[model samples]
Target: MLNLKNYLCCLLLGVVFASPIFAQVPVQKNTFSGGITVTNNGISLLPTFTLGKPAAIFDFAVKSKRWSFEPQLRFSLEGKPWSFVFWGRYKVIDD
Candidate 1:
């Protein structure tokens, strides 16, 4: 199973490449965007079974130029933690 450390590494790599200091192309002004989603089951890529629990998922992002900082949070109705994912994205091609 993938661990938090592995995910962190990937996020870091993206952030490094997406830094404005290194980007050559012109980028748009900063923008804030986010949304919420409700799900019936909080399954984690398992083909066998599901959690069968109701969950609330939140996704938010701050974007500027060719880079964006997006973070996602998931939790059960009972206030239990499901998962947390953070993504740093860079636009390599704008076509």
Candidate 2:
């Protein structure tokens, strides 16, 4: 009888502690969708590749309630094969 009482108490405590997890509600938030950027690197003061040519950049962004991801690709409008850049951002604190 003592063993049965202890088992019931443990089960009750476990259910109480785990109930919140099953009742969670998801959050929704606003986020940026897409953007565009145009840049010229031909006349850069610092020595670099591309030799100062105009390029068109396209960007796409995807975001969750607590996380954001952005991927960008760049190509020379003048038919020069340049480089591709990939990046992402994560939210640590909300105000």
Relative to the true structure, candidate 2 reaches a TM of 0.52
The candidate that achieves the highest lDDT relative to the unseen native structure: 1
**What is the per-residue lDDT of model 2 for residues 25-81, given as tens digits with 9 covering 90 to 100?**
766866777776678763332456454678777788888766777876666887655
Among all windows of ten consecutive residues in candidate 1, which has the lowest summed lDDT?
42-51
Provide C-alpha RMSD values for all models, in order. Answer: 22.5, 8.6
- Tens-digit lDDT string for candidate 1 (1-95): 47888999999998987787776876557999999988888765454534578988888999887899999887888888777878999999864
Candidate 2's C-alpha runs over 4 A off are: 1-32, 42-51, 79-81
Name the Cα RMSD for model 2. Answer: 8.6
Collision count for each candidate, in order: 0, 4
Top candidate, metric TM-score:
1
